[model samples]
Target chain A: MDSAAADRPPLLEVEHVSFRYGPLPVLTDVSLAIREGDFLAIIGPNGSGKTTLLKIILGLLKPESGRILFQGRDIASGGVRPKIGYIPQKATHFDPLFPASVREVVSMAFQASKRGLSRRQGEEAAIRRALEVVGMAEAMDRRIGRLSGGQQQRVFIARAIVDKPRALFLDEPTTGVDAGTQDLFYELLDRLNKREGLTIALITHDIGIVDRHITQVACLNQRLVYHGSHAEFCRSDTLKEMLAGGHHLVSHVH
Target chain B: MGAFLTYSFLQRALGAGLFISLACAVLGVFLILRKDAMIGDGLAHITFAGVALGLFLRMMPLAVALVFSIAASLGIMKLKERAGLYGDTAIAIVSSSGLALGLILATLSRNPGVALLNYLFGEILAIDTVEVVLSVALAAAVVAVIAVNYRKLMFMTFDRESAQVAGVRVRRLDALITVLTSVTIVLGMKVVGILLVSALIVIPAAAGLLRASSFKKAILLACGVATASVAAGLAAAFALDLPASGTIVLVNLILFGVLAARRTPRA
Candidate 1:
């Protein structure tokens, strides 16, 4: 609850990162910093390398140059990826009959944690707590394939938070989800951020509503177009043009 | 029935059938979940060529086939990931090339016509005690790996990206599964034959899918169904003088039909 530490060394620092897929550069010298308890929304147009940037930050993809520092330690130096969590874009490739329950899916997040294999009491407790946080505790026993899109999204969010990560990365978590559910989802995320002081980074095409909900914004298009408070991002010309191109933003008001 | 049961060869055949059924049933669950069912068939064909080559060289065919199939599995995985090719396409390409290479080698070594037929359709009736022990050992190794890495494998199968993000080492786990699949295929080919081995891998898992909820339950059900199918099929094949592989496949198909019918809604 020390707001003064916001200006101290950022919890995550990306220094001059660049990445290329063969010849085409998807990210170019992009740099940004995320402090503790920050809800940072990354917004940009299609092909803007928004997802690419997130991958680099998550250490899923390595940069061609520069380094990513997590808690002032270089991520490449065997810095144990702190309990970082992720909710991927809605997977269209999965079969509807893939047999797994919501609780089973969420419990998998603990597989790589210190808990190891076979769900123990501690892992179950964590899964229950995460589901409760996402308002999905009631539907824990439901088949994942049978859930609504928004409900499924919430289940994945619960899975991501089951490990109680210090940082959480979500890729278009609200896409295809209903407006009401999306509102509820963000509200739950806000609660987690405020209550647990969890840092959050989310990528979305919607720029309009993001400003109202997120503490900071990082507008990307193969580069860091802008990175500042929500107000500064809304006032910037780059974000305005990007949002004007028919990209729906997550509105602050329900 | 008494005469067949009294024969040592028949007993060995039954034992082989049981071991194969158990191993394939377990591995088949993951294959079905991962949607790589066809890869099993493709690799089986590739293993056929290995058996043919082994016959030509007068070596233990299963050992050679295991090495060949494992190599093919690795080759298929590498091609898919590194070249960005569709998984089925990669498997198809490798399978055909392996078959062609195997044929050329067998022809050059002048293997007998009976040896070729045995490799293609299997000769479970001729299974030896050594073959049974080898099959059981391979199956045990696969079961242990699955037990130890169950959680990680489940996470990877459901969501590879999330598993990677959580530091589960997705690629390593995938490679291990592929290798294990190769081992299973090689063992399977000994009893089911190269041409029909994949049926064992697909049918049992598909049957389990009809009713099971959790993956663990599905796999357990698959193993039970598969073992039953093998036992019934072997008995029917012995009684009717039919080919063991064909009988086993028919039994699996019948079981699947019964389960599917039971689960279907009345229109």
Candidate 2:
């Protein structure tokens, strides 16, 4: 709201956002901000409107009230609608009958991202590099349906970041994922966060693996129930309440 | 066989068949993948009303059918949005109404039975030079739109909600596909009759998906299978004194049976 706040803008800002489906109120005055290079985890129950908020921030859903600012510019009418990489909550349900190659799926980033995939290097080079990042270079030409669920998920992640997006949003990425592969996924996300400085906003009902990785946590239940730093979150009474509600970090199963 | 080829009627029939096959096969793969195959069926029913209206008014049937089918397709989309109806529900409502209206109109017209039978069963041999030209032009337009927007359309097909979030202009692409499919149905009605036109749009693509290892292969296989089936079906129609539309659909069913029996690539 002031000039001083404009100097160092957060990567994304959800300012007093609210939404509803028909007459039913889904989200009410929810707000949060993600600074550059921050890995923020949004934890909520099934009906707590986590995915709805993510959709609004991703510009897929229009909020009934309030504004979303990406890099301090209004997302609704902003000139620069930042290139955001998204892994949908239901990414796993992709019909197996659809015969698309792993390479072909990732190549979507070429058309999707406004960041302009590759001007200097050839398109194949970009595809290869992205595959390599996800440890899927060997499976580039393989039919997507032939890969395991975890492997397909990695391919989707590769697709998301192939164009070098500024922010990555993962909506309940761990559901149905095996524990071992889930650890690997978190490690990959951690590497992307710490090494590449890629900002991430992960939405999940489960918050076990991400607890150690996230810098901030926003727990939602149809409203802004908790919004604070991870350290403060660990010590606050809200964390106890969350734990009482069975929202505690689920330990990785060996 | 040679006599059939030399006849101008047969030549026009074959030309229209091939062009419609190309359009249907290409568009069908996307429609089937998007779970919109029933759209073909729905549009075909809508075209029936268009045809009856045209016959009653003494106007060009195909042109009227094209306009009506396109309008009906858009209407289904609008109803789905405004009424919170599911896609299949919207299609069912519009298509059943269109079919009923066509039946009522046909009953009200002079020589109603003969007019209805001609359009329902199709008379490809009676398709004039002008009809052939119109069929080719409409088919070409559908193919061109798909070719230009292949990638974007593919994105929408597999995951429309995600595509919308990713800024793929989902509604525009939805409208484009609906229009293309309606036009394809109009052209295909001449090839296989209104009753079996959807068979042309769904079966070839269904067979293609049974064996394709990738998106490109599915498309190529569908188009190849469709055009070849049309050729062979036309030949059989002449040899057996059967309707080309029925023969073509029979050929497609056989192809689908063979392909479905094959193993699919799995994880």
Candidate 3:
């Protein structure tokens, strides 16, 4: 709310969202707003609907009730989903022998997200720029599986950004990365947010993300316990109570 | 052997076998990556029963196999969805039953004992012009489908959940892949026999993955290896008086061995 970019219309809107598996309510009455240029971190313990909320925002899962709007249009109305970049939390490995270069892998996403043959000349340039942003341009032809976990995540980020999305969503981006790499990852995200003005929604239980790197924070324990500026979240009693209750599930430094 | 090229049966057999090999390799890389390699085995098992059913009914066995394989492919997907069965488990359920039915039909049929063998272990020399034409058409269709949906398929294969979020129709594309692979399996059965046909689908793709650095190159190399194997195997059989299907599978195995060398991490 303190950022200069807050004057613009909100890029994503979620209202009264609720979802559940057969008998268990996973996310109940979840609601939040993400504006342009916001570096919002959705923080929660495992199975706290962090991933489920991200998926619903990404339009991969339909909330049992309520709705998500991207740029003020219903996400279910379609066509806007592609403009949102997503980095999944689940670590599904492609076989080490599966033949796909970083460029090819990104191209698959680029082509699918764009609905074109990708013969356009600028498409490659855009792809190159995206990879360059992630420091992967130099190794675009390397087999994706051969890269280190951090590098693979970078490539995945580049894949998401190739379309120059209005907002980026990441689910546990540093789940498998080492501490050193985690620092570098946040630095890259900071650059993307501050320098490029790209909106970001990062899902992590790691309240460890340096306070300066995040503009806003939403605390969740199957419900939105807090949604406000990072400064306010740092001062909240809700953070203390949630951490006290779910401290066992949170393994990261806060 | 050169004079044998003048025989219409030999020419038809070569053409049909090579086309089928190309198609199988096209579908194989995706199948192998998806860990659905046994779909080939499963479909082939169903294809055997289809052939037997066709023979018993005095009809086109290839058509019967096509219907049977397609149904089995969809059935496997449905079973995996509804029964929460692993991909291979569903395949095993349908495939074992397919083999049993095929065996019972083979026992009751009036054809020569070798007729069942002919379907199980392909006799390339026996391929007629009609089968050749059908295979050619099916191969083209398979290649076209892959071409039109190449990006979507790759995205799904590499990351199904992410692709779904990107608005790609993951379910439809998965069903399409299963159906295409099923048809490829049926057509391939006539070239490599039901027993070894998965080889034509799986091995070339495996080799291609080992040697190639990109998906496009992997698919291209897979098709190339499969086509070359069929040609080499057919020629080797013609020269050595061997069964052409088994020779083709041998050629594929040898190619896989050579290509696998490159897959090791370099020091």
Candidate 4:
């Protein structure tokens, strides 16, 4: 997998990205590459800048010094933004009283992806296909806040994927989900990665997700601790000691 | 009913009220959903400062109010974006200072007490042709901006970060909404008064979102509720010989109460 990934130019590259809040540094010269069709899990301990790094890559924040390149083009120059979908960390933390149907929320991604005087051409079909992929077709007309936590996350995933993004980034998608639902969520992500060949980068504290679903692993601690195949990550004695030491990694059981 | 149609002042008040209601209700839905509802209230306070400053200078109060509130609204947005202050905290800081400034200005401009009271509580029946024309123009602008940016605004209101990732130009839209809201609040001052103007913005939207199944329905229902309440409140105020702003706000509160009662069982 490493050789294969190396053979193809990386789909997304984060080079020497550093960020700070006020005077205190949050990320210190961190860099990693995400290849096409690679299901990479970014794991780190609390305050490890895992989320901040993802925000920079997604263009939510400006890096102090580094740059992000998508398909070998600097995204800052800004022609067509790399078709990427994001489910933010506070995705499910939206106001419960917000009145929006599942279909409307999904369709918003389609409308929002386009500029000015949006024509609703193919919008319904796109929303339906996205919902069907997320196994949420049955709840298309239901209010999003009426759904359970895991189901809401699935709807958000549908929203992210409705525009048919080349790569998907999710920040802590299953933070409040139940144990049983977490398994199903991971299964859905696995299907997206394997069956649909969608590239996925996820920020998680769950070490278990790396073993179960991720093909590639990028461990971060305000820096790129490791970025390689899941097998290499598991076998590396140095990383295992670092994980056991609880300095750079925090693993959640369920 | 014939008198309502015949009185020129009543016609002007109704004309301005309906437009103001439509603008407020539509803008209110986005503000309510974004949890930035207090912004209308905040801008209303700033409008008070504007009015007081204008009166002290012996100038057109509404124009001064519009400019002052717009600048203050942008300041609030900057504080939230750059200073990392929470929305309510920023609103509170700006709004309290506005109220204080208005009080000082009112004191300095002494004996404009009757004119100040007219603005504080609203004298809708006394609305003139110019105020009515200004209301129509500003309300039209508000509707146009919202209609043009409807999709982006909905996406942003639902989830700001995801909308940003989708390249929605969220900050620009945020500024647009804030400026539009400031304009709406300033226009509302004549119909509902500076003190109760936000009620016209919030109560109807709250009622609409309480029962709406879709975003479109929420907006439509809010507009419906706002317009209906203004019409009813005007007639009731004329009959009861009460203050127009208070009556209009009461009518909105009643409608919201009814909707809440109907919704509580289902929730």
Candidate 5:
């Protein structure tokens, strides 16, 4: 939120990242940086490698050539990963056959981080706080698949942030939700960014999110076409160029 | 029932059957939730080849079958990962190869005989003490791994990609599941035969998923269903003069039918 926050060191950086699927290139020399407390949206058309970049950053996929740094350290060195969380694309559509309660769903974050044979400790408070933050504390014991789409999305957000990760990444999180919930969802991201100072990165084709909530924008179509503050992105002709280039952009209203 | 239990062979069969059922039921919950339920059937077919190879070599049949099934399970995983084949496609290729190889070996062997017949359609009543001990040991190992890694496995099953991001070691856990499923399948072949072994791994778990409100309950319900079915199916087989393997699967199918028919709220 600070105007000169970019002057400070970046919290996360992607340097000279390139990725390919066999012979086809998905991303080419894509590079970007996220400063602390910034709400950045990685905007791109459908095939623009947005999710691929996110996967690379999350260490789910190895880029063909690149290095990812968290707090100026190579992430591949196998130290403790900088505390970060992810809510994957289409997360709300998780198998209905997964018979876990809302509490159990949130508890998975802790379960993944736990070590040794020691029993789960202090995670109860963490789970409760996360549920309360998402306002799903009342549904803690309910089956996750039984919730409405919006509610499930919030529960996923809680699961993502339950560990108090310094950074949160989301991928097309509002694909099937109604418009009403999308507005509230963006507002929730806004609150987390402003109040908690959590660094946030989201990938979506929705151009409206770029205008409304995000502080920085990184436009992608196989390359880093534009990366700047929201004000600069709006003041430039880049949006016009992207539109004329026939890249798909969904313009929606809250 | 008491009189039947008095027979030593009946006791051996019952003990081995119950343990194998518990192992299958627990692992089945994961297999069903992960949508990899058919891996059990695939591995069972592979077990058929393993048994044939054991017969051909005149070796410890269960040991050779165990090795064959585990290797084939790993092969299925590799085919999915490295070969870029769809999961079911890879399973189909590996399982059919196993069946074909098994048939060939049986044809080539001078006396494939009732020993092979017994494995194809389980002869639990004639199970030896060594096989019962092996069944109990392997089943306990499978159940222990599930208990120890239950939470991590649950996370991976719920959302594999997110679980990887969370550093849950998805690949290792996936390998662990396949290997454990391999063990369960090999043990289950003795109780329900290679043809019907997957029924023990899939049906009870499906029944649990049908109505349980939580994962813990689902596992508990699946175990209960599997244990009861095996017990009743074995008794019915004795009383009605039927094959235990077929009877066990029929009971499982009937229970699944009853569960499916019950009314429940759906999201």
Candidate 6:
């Protein structure tokens, strides 16, 4: 496959976006252009507006000013929202006692897919394939509430990828999972980006783990500080300063 | 047993018990899933106000009560969403206001005699043919909606944000389910009255949770427990010539106690 195909018209573009939550500015003059097949890791300290940026991209939060474009079209203009999938930071907001099988949770992602296939067969196949991708195929029949935190997170990831979305937004997907499980999770995401060419935007606070796995990094603290490659981000003095809680630093590393 | 089956009032009591049990059991599942069991209690009190207002206006109490309860449910939902009021606080506000309003209306009415007690505790034997028809219709409607949108409702209940992200219209579904729950509450009010109707929603579902491994099984078991309680309660009420509402609630309490005991691990 030609690498140039990934460099086509940017898949997502946030132009001069600003958002405030009741007089408190969360994001100001935030702008970013995400290319296809990029594993973009957004890193920042607590309350740094990292998750807010991802929410804007997913159209969950509206910007007070400016526009977000998806495939060169305004995202708010009904431009095929099904192409985007989101894994929320708190998937446990789902009732722990509510009974649902892993397969049922995973297959629900394809509910919006355009495939006109048999509902049962299509859902089953998609669930199986997604679970297999996340190494959770064996636990398909298990109740979601009974699974461990790592296993539950993997199930959610499977749900996100089952639809074959153009872009995947994961908010702290490895928050409570062990280091080994987190490593496996990132490896699966890396494979999806490398082999299947899926675009991923992850919001995480673990800078150390991210430094080793992410291809691109964007550091946020309410505004854009710098935008470039991951190598540049690791070497940047501004990031070091921001990490020390000195000032705002929003850098996009390619 | 033969004498109990022959009386018209006993037959009506039995029918009302069956209807309330089935409807409350189904609605109870959603309540438990949403973690808004208190909302059931709140709505039942609101339905009490509707019942009182219906009697005062000399209208078909059930119809008036249904309309008023559905409206109250919608109001509570809107307040929670728009004002960002916590669900429990919103329920409290609606319930207390409703109870107050009902009390005022009953006080101003001419014949506040048995009607007030009926709304408070329930009057299962008073269920007429119209109430029976309405109960059956509402139960069928609840079943139809649940059957058709089981997956959608389950998805919404599990993770509302993801459901919205998947284009499931979370707000609309939430409101719809609330309306459905209000209908169930109103139907239940006719049997167990407002004070006891909410118990019918919680006890069976809590019992079902102890034993069932899946959502469907839990719901089915809840319905079974509720139905059994209703039947046994109605029979005991007729045999002892006691109040049907007290009898039904006693039966539920007994079931709950037995289930809780069975779940306890031996030292």
A196 in model 4: Cα distance from truth in Å?
1.7
lDDT of 3 at B226: 93
- The better-scoring model by DockQ among 4 and 6 is 4
Per-residue CA lDDT of candidate 2, range B101-153, in tens?
Answer: 99887777675677668778777778889989988988988888787777777
Off by over 4 Å in 6: A1-6, A93-95, A110-119, A235-254, B1-16, B82-87, B264-267
Model 2 spans > 4 angstroms off = A1-8, A78-80, A113-121, A244-246, A249-254, B1-4, B113-115, B264-267
The C-alpha local distance difference test score for the whole of candidate 4 amounts to 0.88
Give residue A217's lDDT in candidate 3 (0 to 100). 90
Q: Candidate 4 chain A: minimum summed lDDT over ten consecutive residues — where?
A: A245-254
Residue B114 of model 4, lDDT score: 89
Model 1 chain B weakest lDDT span, ten residues long: B258-267
Name the top lDDT candidate: 5
Report the C-alpha lDDT of model 3 over B1-267, residue by residue, as the tens digit: 677688788899988887888889989999998989888998899999999998888788889888988998899899999999854899999999999998898777778377778888997789877778888999988988887788888888888887887778989988999899889988888887899989989999988877777888999999889988988888899889899988999999998888876566621
Predictions' DockQ, in order: 0.50, 0.44, 0.57, 0.54, 0.57, 0.35
Model 3 regions lying over 4 Å from their true place: A1-6, A78-82, A113-118, A243-254, B1-4, B261-267
TM-score of each: 0.92, 0.92, 0.94, 0.93, 0.93, 0.89
Model 2 achieves a DockQ score of 0.44
Cα lDDT for residue B193, candidate 4: 89
Q: What TM-score does chain B get in every candidate?
A: 0.94, 0.95, 0.95, 0.97, 0.97, 0.94
Predictions in order: lDDT: 0.82, 0.84, 0.84, 0.88, 0.88, 0.80
Candidate 6's error at A98, in angstroms? 3.4
CAPRI quality band, candidate 1: medium
Real contacts recovered, all predictions: 0.62, 0.50, 0.58, 0.67, 0.70, 0.38
